[model samples]
Target chain A: MYRGLLWLCFLPSLLFGQRTDSLRIDFRPLLNGVALELEEEGGASAGAREVEVLRFYLSELQLLEGEEVVFAEEDHHHLIDAAQVASLQLPLTLPPGLRYDGLRFTLGVDSLTAASGVFGGDLDPTNGMYWTWRSGYINFKLEGTSPDCPARKQRFQFHVGGFQAPFNSERRVTLAIKPARSISIIIDLDSFFAATDLSQQYQVMSPGELSMKVADRLTRMFRVE
Target chain B: MRQGVILLVVVMMSGLAFTLSSPPGIAYPDHFPTTAYDFRAHPLDSAKVQLGRRLFYDEILSADGTISCASCHSPYNAFAHTDHDLSHGINDQIGTRNAPALFNLAWSTSFHHDGAHHSIELQPLAPISHPAEMGSSIGDIVRRLSEHAQYRQAFSESFGDSLVTGERVLKALAQFQLTLVSAGAKYDRVQAGKDTFSVQEQKGYQLFQTYCNDCHFEPLFTTGGFARNGLRVDTTLNDFGRMMITALPEDSLLFKIPSLRNLSYTHPYMHDGRFRKLRQVLKHYASRDVRPMPISANEQSDIVAFLLTLDDRDFVFNRNHGFPH
Candidate 1:
C-alpha cells in the first residue's frame, strides 16, 4: 500500500518531465578589434592613455516572445567588473521548454531596488559600487587614465547612478534575436570613448544630468551576436 | 502504545517551553508607529548584535586605526557629538554637518541631514570611506578583520562561518544600532498612564501640540519627514541641504526632520549645530519671516521644560550600549 501511494505521488512529475534551460551571457568589453584589460594601457582617440576600471549593474532580465512575456528572472542583480574575468560571463536559468524571440533588460538597477533599503548580494554596500555620501548605487562605473585628461594620473572616472525623477539614470535595452539556445552580447567601449570628451568631462562621480547623458549613451552600446 | 503517546506529549511540551524561554527581540510602546525597517530580511541574533557592538568600538575600521563610530557618536550624548558644531573624524578633520544622534533608527525612513541614505545598514559606508572620516575601504577592513583571530572566532560564532564579508559587517552593525530604542522617557511614562506631567510641563505640552506637534509628533517625537524650518543659508558652508540630493529648486533648504527625543543630551542642535541652547532654537523658530509661529519668552521656557520631559535618562546611562570592557 505504501509503494502504491509513493507511485501515485511520483506519477505526475514523471509524466510531465520538466526540464530547465540555461542562458549564458558573455559580456565582451572591446575597443574595436582589441579586448579591454584592466590596469593596462589601451589606445583611444587623440593620444588618450588607458582603461583602468569598468563596472556596471545588469538587472531585470526578461525573455519576450512577440508581445508576450515568456520568462522573467526574479530578484536578478548582477555586477560586472572588468578586473575579474569571471564576472564577464553571466549564467541564468530559464523556465522549461520556453521559446524566446527577444530580450529586454535594464542596464541599471530599477528605482524600486534603489529606494528599497540596504540589501545583500550584488547590491550590498560593501561592493564599492555604492556611493558613501549619497544613497544610490553606482549603476555604471568606468575609470581610466587618459593623457587628454588633466586630472592627476591623467585619470577619468564616471560613476553614473540616480533613481529619482528629473535625473533617473536607469536605461532599458531591448534586442531582437533569432530564437536560440544561447546568446552573446558585445559591449563596444570604442563607441563610448568616441562619443565622450575626456578632456571636457573627465569625472562624473555623482548623479545628475551628466550621469544620465552617459547612461543614455551606454544603452545603445549593446549588440547581440 | 501508551508509552509512545506519553513520550510524544513530553517532547511537544518541552518544545513549547523552549519557544517561550527565548529572549524578546525589540520592545516599543503600543502608540508608536510600525518600524520602517523590515526585520524579516535580517532577523535579530544576540550573537550578531554583540559582535557588532565590538566592531562599533574598534578603531580597526579606520585607515590609521585612530577612530571608530564611538568617536563621533558618543553614548553619553545619545550617540551624537556633544560640543562640536561640525563632526571631527580621523586626523582631526572637520566634517561638513553635525553628527546626528543614533537611536530609534528602525523607525527612520531616511538618513543624514540631506536624506542621502535610505537604509540604516548602508549608512556606515558614508563615514567609513569619507575622506574626512575613517577613510578606509570595505575591502581593506574585510581583509584586516579576516586576519584577526578574535574577529574570525566571533564571526564564526555569530554567523556560523568565519569568513568576513562586507555584507556581514554592515548587517551586524545595523543589528546593534537597531537595538538602540529610546522609548523609556518620562513623556512615555505619562502617555502609558504610569505618571502625570507637572503643571508647567502640562502647559508646555499644550503649547507644543499647538506649535510643534505637526512636525515633531509625539511618541517617536518626529514625523520622519523633511522641512525647511526657515534657516537661512550659511555663507561659509554653502550647504544647500536636500537640494544636492533631489536637484530640485523647491528642495533647496529642506532638511531631514530630527527627533525631539533626548534634547538635553543632544545639544548644539540643528543640522549644523548652529544653536547651542534650546532658547536660540526657539528664537529662530519664533522670528522666522516665513510662516513664523510667534511665542513669548515665557512660552519658550515652557516648551523647553516640555522638551526636557522627552529625555530618556535610562537610555543614555544604559551600560548595554556602551563599550564591551
Candidate 2:
C-alpha cells in the first residue's frame, strides 16, 4: 500500500519538475603591486590618500552556455565600489539533470540602454551614471586620488561611456565554471592602471571614444574563479 | 479535476486579455506620412495616453509644483508659449531658447533646437531636468506619480503590472505626442485638388518654391535638419548650437530648421524668437546679405504668401487635443 502511494506521488513529480540552483556573482577589485596614478598629483600612489575609491557599474548581465546566451537581464547597472564587491544571486531552473559549464556577461550597459529614455531607480540619471548636457550613460566610472595624479587635491573622476559608432564602447567577458559553481570575478586594478596612460586619460567625465578604450581595457581583467 | 480548473482559468484569462487590449482611437488623414515612432515597441492604450495627458498638464512635475509642460506649451496657442520671446519656467527662469510650437512631432528625426535629443522617448527628460525649466528629476516624478491611485491603476493597465518608471513616463509622453498629427490643412485640401489658392497665394507659392522650400521642404514644412540660417549670435548666451553635442567647430551656429506648418499660431520665429512677425522673417530672408543669397522684394512677398498656405487650421483648433481636465 505504501509503495503504491509512493509511486503515485513520484509519477507526477517526475513528469512535471526538475531541480533548480542559484548562481552567485562576486566582484573584486585588486590593488596590490599596481601603479595607481591619480590625476591631480603627478606620478604618485593612490595609496597615499587615506581613503580612495575606484567604483563603477556592471550592467546587462547574462549567462551563456557555449554560443548560446541562456539568461539575459538588461538595464541592471549594479555599482561596485572599492568597499563592497557587487554580487547578484540569480535563481535558475535548469533542465532535468542539466549542468551549465560556462557563463558570459557584459561589464557595461549596451547601446540600447544609452539610447533609451530616462529610467527611474537604479537606471535613473540621478545615480550619477548619466550625463545631462550630452545624452549617454557612463558605462564605467573610475574615481580616486593619487599623489602621482595631477588633479589630486580635488576628487578626480573617470566616467567612461558612449555607444555610438566610432566611439561605441562597453566590454564583455566569458568564463568556464564547471559543475555550475558560483564564481567571483577579480577586476585587477593593476591591469587597468597599467593599460591607461593616466596623464592623457585622467579626468574623463563624459562619453566618447577615449572612454571606450578605457572600458575595453578594463574588461580584459575579468576572469572566472 | 486540477486540469479542468487550469483550463477554466486559462480561458478566463484570455477573454479578459482581449477586452483590455482593444484597439485605440487613432484616426488620421490618408495623405499624411507614416509615423516615424514605432508603436509596437511601446504600444498605446487609451489608459496610458490619458495618464500621460494628465502628467503633461500637471504642475506637480515641477520642483515647486507650479510649472508643468503646458505652462510653456499651452494647447490654446497650439502648444507654444506666446507670453515671452524665450520660454519661462520655474521661478520665472527664462530659458535661452524660444519654445517652439509642438505638433505633428511624430515625423521629427530629433528634438531640441540643436538636435541634442535623438529620440522622442528621451525628449521630456531635457525639460524635466533643465535647471531653468521644470527642475525636477525623473525619480521624484515617478515617486510622486506612484502616490496617486489613478496613476497607479493607469500604470498597471498600461504596462502590465509594472511600477511607475521614468521610461514608462517618457514613453507615455511620446505616445501622446505621436497622436498630434496635423494633416487637415487648407494646403492639404489644395494638394487633393479640392480647392485653389488665390493669385497672391499662388505668387507666394512660386516664391517659396524658389527659396524657402530648400530648407522647409514640403507637406510637413520642415526638413528636420540643422542650418546656420545666418543669425548673429547673442553675446550673452553665445549658444553654439550643434557644436554643443558634436564638439566640432564647423557645426557652430547650426540650429534645427523650424517647421512652418503652424506659422500663423507659433509667433516670434527663429530659435530665440527674434522675429515677432512673419514680415520680419521675410525681410530677414530678403536681406540675403545674411546667407549670401539674392532674395528680391517681390520674391519675399510671394514666399510669405506661400508660408501662410502651409497653415493647418484643423490642428490648432482640434477639440480632441484640448486640456485633459
Candidate 3:
C-alpha cells in the first residue's frame, strides 16, 4: 500500500520536470565552411581575397522573454578578433523555468558613444577601433585586395560605422533556440556580402547612414543552426 | 642715518595695517551688467572655499597623481596660465587649446573654447578625461581619493555622504572658481565718478565703444558669444572651434569671445595663445578687414588704453584667495 502511493507521486513529477528544460546558446561566425561572393548588378563575379578582421564589439545584447528585456547590456566593451569571432560563446544567465522564446543582439557601437568625449580601454584610439582624424568607429572592417575594388594592390578596406538620424547602422536580430539543448548561432559570411555591394559603398569611416544600411542587412544574416 | 630709519619704520607700520584691513570681495560700480553665476547653488563659505582651494592645489585628481588644476591656472597671474600656449597635463602631454582666464567666470554662460561644456559644473570632465590633459578616468580618481582618510572625511563634510564621484570633484573646483569675481578697477571708479580716465584713456574708450563694443561689450567686456574673430586655422590641429559640437559648417572658425578685463595680467590672447602682447591683439583687430569692421592703428591704441582701465588690482592681489599655507 505504501509503495503504490510513492509511485503515484513520482510518475507525474518525472513527466513535468524534464519537459521544460533550459537551452544553452553558443554564437559562432562561420570562418572556414563559408564562401563569400559579392556580385554587382550585372552578375559580375567578385573573386575571393584574403582579409584581416578589424574588430567585433557588442553594440547591444538583449535576451527577450516575450516583451520584457530579461537581460540587456549597452556599450559592452568586449573586444574579439577574427579567430575569436569565428567561434564566440557568451554565457548568459536567464530567469529560471521561463524559457527564452527569442534572442536579439546588435553588431557595432551606437552613435551616441561614438560622438561623446574621449574613452579609454577597449574604446580608446590606441586599440585601433577609433578613427584618429575622422570622428567615429571603424566598425565591421574587412580589408583585402579585390579585382572589383578601385584600389587593387592596396588592401580593399570596408570600415562601416554610422548612427544618427539619417545614418543609423546598428543591426538587430531575433532567433529561436531549441528546448533543453545548446543553440549555436552561425553568422554566414556568404549571405552578408551577398546582401550589399561593397564596390559602391566601399569604405565607411563614421556613424552615418551607410554604416546602418550594411549593419542592418548583415545582422539579419545570423541564424540558429 | 637715524632720520632715514625712522621714516622706514613708519612706512612698514602703515603697510601692515593696510594689509590687515583690506576687503575680500569685488566692489562693483554702476553701469555694469549683473553677475550671471548663481552663487545661491553653492553659497560662498570661507571654510568651503578653503577646502576647495586645497583641492585645486592637490595633485590627487590625476591618475599618476602628478598634476592639479592649479598646475595650469595659477593664482598669481589672475588665475590665467603663464609661459605656455597650450595647457599641459599628466605625463607632460600637451592640450590642443589655450586655457582661458578664470576671473569674471561668474559672467560666463559656458566653458571651454568650443562651448562643449554647458554648465561650469561639467567643465572638469573635459580635462579629466582628455587624453592630452589629465589622462585619467573620474572613477579612477574617486577610487584614489577614497583611499585617503583626509579626503574621505572631507567628502562627508562637504557632500553629507562619504561617497566620492566625478560630480563632487567638478563641483568643488567650480565653487572655488566662482568666487573669483573682478569688479574693482579704475574703470569702475570712473563709472562711479569717484575717478576719471586720463585723456588718452578717454580716447581709447571712444575707440572701444565704436568697434570692440559690438562683441566685447562693456562691463563684463564680452558679449559671451562665439565669433569667427578672423583667426586663420592652425594646420596641424585643424580644430573646428564650435563646429565640433554643432557640426555646422558656418561655425567653422568661430570661438568664444573672451573677457578683456584682466588684459594686463592675462597675456597671450586668443584661443591658440597666438598673440603675446596686448599691442599684437590691437594690431590683429586694427588689421581686421577679415571679418568685422576695419579698425585703425590710432583707434587700436585707444582701445588698448581703454582695456587698461578694466584691470582690477584688488581682485588680482587678494591674499585671502591665494595659495593656502
Candidate 4:
C-alpha cells in the first residue's frame, strides 16, 4: 500500500514529465582577454586603474531563434558580485529538450520592478544595490583606484541606474550561440575601459547622462565564445 | 494504515498553512483614501505586526545600539520627535531635516522630506544606512539578528523558519507601519455626524477650503505630494529639497506637503522644524516672502482652533501602536 502511494506521487513527473534542465549563464570578466582577479596588485599603471569591486544586476534572460523567443525567465533578477564566486554563474531552468539559437538579457533591473518597491532574495535592499538617498537601484557598480584620479584616495566609483526617461541606464545585450549546457559570456573589461575616458570622466555615482552613456557602451563588452 | 496516516498528516499540514495567512487588520474609516501600500506583497498578520513593533522600539537597529525608528518617531508625538529640531542619531550625531510624523503612512506614496524614497518597505534603508542617522547597514543588522535567540524564534513565528533576512525584517516593519491609520480625530467624528463643528471652526473650514484645500486637501487633510511652501532657504543647511533627488532646477525648493492632521501633537512644522507653534507657521504663510496668503490675526486664530480639532487622542495614546510592554 505504501509502495503504491509513493508510485502515485512520481506518476505526474513520469507521465506529464515536469523535469527541467537548467542552463548555466556564466560570466567571465576579463581585462584585455585576461581574467580579472580583484585586489591584484601591479595591475594599475599611470592611467590604468585596478578594479576593487565589480557588481551588477542581470535580469530577464531570454532564449531566442531568429526573432522568436523560445524560453524566457519570468523573474531572473540576479545580483552578480565579483566577491562572491558563486554569484558569477546564474542558472536558468528550461524544458529538458528545449533548444534555441541566441540568448538575450537586460544588463540592469527593469523599470517595472524598480517601481514595485522592495523584494527578497537577490533584490533585497540589504545587498547595497538599491540606493539609500533615492528610489532607484544601482544597476551596475564598478569601483577601483588609480594614480591619475583627482578624487579622494585616488578612487573611482561608477554606479549606473535610473528608471525615468532621458536618464534610464538599463541596456539590452544579445549574442548568438550554438546549443550548449553551459553558456560562457566573456566580459571584455579592456574594451570597456578603452572606450571610457577614465582619466577625466571617472566619477559617475548617480544616474544621469554620463551613466546612460556608460550603460550603452556596456553592451559591446560581452563576447560569447 | 501507514499510507493512510501519511495522507492524514499532509491534509492537516495544509490546514495549518491556511490558518497562517490572516485577514487584513489595517482599520480605517470608509471615508479615507485608498492605500498606496500593497498588502498582497506584505500581508499583515498579528505575529508579524507584533514582531515589527518590537524592532521599531528596540535600539538593536542602530550601530551603537542607541537608536531605533521610535527614537526619532515617538508614538506620544504622533511618531515624530518633539524634543529635537533635527534628527539625532547614534553618538551625538545630528542629521539634516526634521524627522516627519508617521501616522496614516499607508496613504503616502512617497517618504522623507524630499520624497526621496518611493517604497515604504525599502524606505527604512535610508535612515538605517545614513551616516548621521542610525549609522548601520541593513547587512550588519541582519547578521546581528541572526545571532539572537529571541529574534530567531520571532522570525520563525513571523516567517516560516528561524532564518533571518533583510526582506523579512523590512516587510514586518512595513506591516506594522501600515496599521498606523489615524482617522479617529474630531473632524472624522463631525464627518460621521457624531459631533458638530464650532462656529469659529466652521468659518475656518470655509477659509481653509478656499485657501489651503488645494495643497492641503480635505478628508485626509493633505494632497500627499510635494510643494514649494515659500520658506526662505536657510543658508546654513542649503537644502535643495526635491531638487537634490531629481537634479532638476524646476524641482528646486519643493518639499513634501505634510498632512494638517494631528498638528498639535506633531509640533515644529515644516521640513526644517522651523515653526515651534501653529501661529508662527500661519505668520510665515501670510508674510508672503515666497507665496501670498493674506489673513488677519482673528482668521489665523480661527484656523488654529480648527487645526486643534485634528488631534486624535485615541491614535496618539493607543497601546497597540505604543512600545510593546
Most lDDT-accurate candidate: 1
Which portion of correct inter-chain contacts appears in model 3? 0.00
Q: Which stretches of candidate 2 lie over 4 Å from their true place?
A: A1-23, A31-104, A116-130, A144-153, A173-180, A190-202, A220-225, B1-25, B153-162, B288-291
> In model 1, how large is the Cα lDDT of residue A156?
88
Question: How many clashing pairs in candidate 2?
Answer: 15
Provide the TM-score, chain A, model 1. 0.86
Q: Write candidate 3's Cα lDDT for B1-325 as tens digits.
A: 9989999999999988965664343334557675666554445555456667777888886777888877888777778887677889888888887888887776777677877654565567556667777777666777788898988788778878777665566567777777787888889888888999999899989878887888888788888899888777888788889776555577787898888887788777789888899888877766666765576777777778889999888888987768878
What fraction of the correct interface contacts does each predicted structure contain?
0.67, 0.35, 0.00, 0.71
Candidate 2 TM-score, C-alpha based = 0.80
What lDDT score goes with residue B83 in model 2?
55
User: Model 1 over residues A1-225: C-alpha lDDT tens digits?
Assistant: 999999999998887656666778788888654787666654354464577788899899888899788888788898988788888888877767678888888888888988876677888777888888887888998888777788876778888998888888988899897655567788888888889898898898878878888998888778886
Q: Rank all candidate structures by their TM-score, best first, as comma-separated numbers.
A: 4, 1, 2, 3
Error of 4 at B60 (Å): 0.7
lDDT of 3 by residue, A139-204 (tens): 666555544555545345667664444555555677764344567777676576666465675665
| Interface RMSD to the true structure, each candidate | 1.6, 2.8, 8.2, 1.0
The list of candidate 1 runs beyond 4 A from truth reads A1-20, A39-46, A95-97, B1-18, B21-25
* Model 4 chain B weakest lDDT span, ten residues long: B18-27
Model no. 2, DockQ: 0.32
Cα deviation of B12, candidate 1, in Å: 6.8
TM-score of chain B of each: 0.94, 0.89, 0.86, 0.92
